[model samples]
Target: MKNNKIFLIGLLAMVFLTACNEDVLEYKPEGLLSQADVSTTENLEGLVIAAYAGIANDEMVGPITHQWVYGSVRADDAYKGGGGIGDVDVINRYEMYNLTIPDYGDWMTPKTWVNHYKAISRANFALELINEASEADFPKKTLRQAELRFLRAHSHFMLKLLFKKVPYIVETMTAEEKANATNDMTNDELWNMIADDFLFAYNNLPQSQDEVGRADRSAAAAYLAKLRLYQAYEQNDTHQVTSINPARLQEVIDYADDVTGALEPDFGNNFLDGFDNGSESIWAAQFSINDGTLVSRVSFVTGLNSPNSTELYGCCGFHLASQNMVNAFKTDTNGLPLLDTFNDVDIFDSVDGNGKAPLAPGITLDPRIDHTVGIPGRPFKYRNTVNEAGDMIYNFSWARDPGVYGYFGNMKEQQAPDCSCYVKEGPFVGTSKNVDFIRYADVLLWKAEALIQLNQVSQGIAIINRIRDRAANSTNRPINAGATDVYAIGTYPLTLSKEDALKALKFERRLEFAMEGARFFDLVRWGQAAQVLNGYVAVEKTKRDFLANAQFTAGRDEYYPIPQREIDVTGGLYTQNPGY
Candidate 1:
């Protein structure tokens, strides 16, 4: 019997006969169309949609769009919380920086390189085809070109951060030209090349787009600020920051000023499903479910990170909050973070097997903790609303393997299991929620960073305090406000010294953006990866034995080794990054 409700994905394929190779259709092979047939204006615009789809192709482990593994698990923010050490061995190796492994055939490394290049190829193809069309045929030719360039630059920026040195591919390059391309650009030159794309995008893109998902001038401005912030830390071939570029820091401030209302009034709004594209959002990858489509465009990339069998969410659990992260939320008697001694006490000390850990009476924590992480006895997201029957609980029995991975659940990525947005695809669970690639809070933090590096330490402290003040007042808490847990957060001291101000800024970012996949990258840019991570390993090893022998080498651990498959494809044209 044929099922009428079952839809086929074959109807949505996009076929392109490229001048370089007819085999290019392997990536997206649905509709049959020739490149020569792409001369019409409508066909040119369709190419842009195809380019946008590339970012959504992220599933499981995309080094481009999803950073759960690379940025969070690889840092101190999260642990590889699956079944056990042998569950996903490659990821476990990555968590330990076990690069000495001879076999680099893991699926993530090559898949990351391939998926990003696939997006680049589409943008390059679109650009060439758009050029062939007349301005009369496509009146918005410049705008389309600008959009495609932004996509291309975005892909390159993702690659640069993950691989450090990647070939700069453009539409001007032929198939033969690209095959012979190499990752030979100097660090400074590579950054400038990426900056050029964002600069072009900033000048040509409109202030707002008619489409909800399109990148606008403000998005371009925000991206340029991010790029400039990274560029301001001038690094040498060895991946060490040689000097700080003052002019580049100034550019960050200049570009940040051009961005409007990038910071939302409430931090909770940024994590909700519907308010994803709000004014505070600089840019986000769009997702839709039940929108007359066969399947959702939802991000299944972090599917493995959901909670285990429970009433709230039934599935695997791959990314759990580290004890270090939980401890970092502890505040002093003055309602401020005990930055130096926060790690002295463990949050799990009072917990029993049922995952019930009651804080001492009058104990206070930042309200953001409930929004960012799911701890036992605490509400998950706003799941504890007044009208609901009960709260969405994070039960210790819900953990896949609590003996190894802790009982903490990731709240930011998962919706209530009973919510319409949650989709149960077999044993795994996913959600039709938009993923923010860059938000306004990120821009504000970047601005604060620039101010600190420019010697305006007081101004930087003020900006950091503003974020703290927001977190202190953020209302994303359990609806049934009880006296069990305290919510106390204080602003930074205005008379802070430069050294103290720097420490405060770093701590604030950790508390503000925990588990959102920005921790490792922040440490790297600050040139503190070695010191910070080594210290983390020392303390955490006493908690988890898998990390007892883990170490982070200064020169080697800064960037992941380029996939051996990519190097093989280049036929020795590409040189391996240092200490690979």
Candidate 2:
């Protein structure tokens, strides 16, 4: 009996020892990585890569980078143009400026806050890791840190533009410090701090990077110029324009002088699929399709703006160009744009009472109108084709609801369905088209704005004419040019008054970057939002009933509110912006 009991005890001990073996206990979980795992030079490069990855993500919040919904629709350039307001109800409310604190669009506000901070957090982590490693340990330590700082500044700039108040976070902050971070910095301090990161990047980064998408000195210079341009236009707490600093304007020109990229000979070159990351592109987010992945690494941020349920494009149409925007393309007999009188006559006006017919056959229009907008009877860029009777014309039957929204479809943001860059995911069509965050033309325009502000009106006129020359000479006309309507565009007159030059600069920017999302910011910077947007609503309400009673309050509508969720998470460390 004693021997049998001893045998049972020995058997149990053997089982327990096998289960508790070191090999079994110390095994790492599948696909999990630790700090030590990524402590090498190549691995640190990968970490910076991860930080860059944050900007090119699929989240609407993070890089909500595409400004079609927020910039274009909210401004006068576009309509909330999906099936109806209900297609994305939040967008409708945003367009109307009737957003509530707990409205659905407010959800995007918090998400944007979270995403920008998430990107900043990644940058902070990379900086910390880089700090621990020596130059001998990491050969590209300085460049990597510069790149990360540029990214961090980029994220912060986006936040600053969207939300007037944000908590700035950096690597040195302890968890408690981060939790206690507040938004009490003065406007000048905030702009200067953000500019410091770009200045550091501009000093440290190379002229060009071996990797395609990496930040270079030119990119840093361009972004710094943009930052300085915004800084030059100072605003009060109530969002009224207090002053435009002449010193800061000179700074914009100085920084813009550093950008050496040339304008593409053809303006259309900036929009096509194959022309991405061209010489004109100072910095662009990279995308890839057919890189051996099941799904393409493309941005669908503008996917919803594609025409609804058509063979040319497969989904919702959300960024329909406003009739007002379309009319802004109208040119007078001498081939100059109608800066003041464009809105008096709608593009759809016809001899008969009905306004539904195609545009008048011989009416002269700016050539850029063909590239930036899709008219009903004209050729639709690369998608021009022959239908049943074999007459070539791009159809607008795909427009979700032309009665509610105008008939003009956004053209620059989409690609031809037949292009290699095009991809379909369920009902939406996405493309690998790189969004040109900053272009050389942007540098020119920024410099022009600065020059004009400094009373160098004639010099600014030359720059403005330089841009108009490119638009006038652009050769991206329809395949059957003889069959298309009349196209006319010309440069500004050599001599112009200071007032006329500024108006020319403003109108030129509207045309150059129509759907690319610079409209609202321009209006805000020029201290014309109340005058321009209020007048816009007064007229637009007659066209779009949805905008009835839509008001742009001077103090309240300048910036969106700080997210309520962020306030809750920080336990009230952050204060809400005025008027929510």
Give the best candidate by TM-score: 1
Q: How accurate is candidate 2 locally (lDDT)?
A: 0.76
- lDDT tens per residue, model 2, 47-115: 687667666654533335777766788899999888877877777877887754743455666666666
Off by over 4 Å in 2: 1-31, 60-63, 102-105, 349-357, 387-392, 479-484
State the lDDT of candidate 1 residue by residue for 366-457, as single tens digits.
77888888777666667655234245655567678877877777888877665666677877776767788888788888888899878898
How accurate locally, in lDDT, is each candidate?
0.77, 0.76
Off by over 4 Å in 1: 1-31, 101-105, 385-391, 479-481
Residue pairs in candidate 1 whose N, alpha carbon or C atoms collide under 3 angstroms: 13-30, 13-31
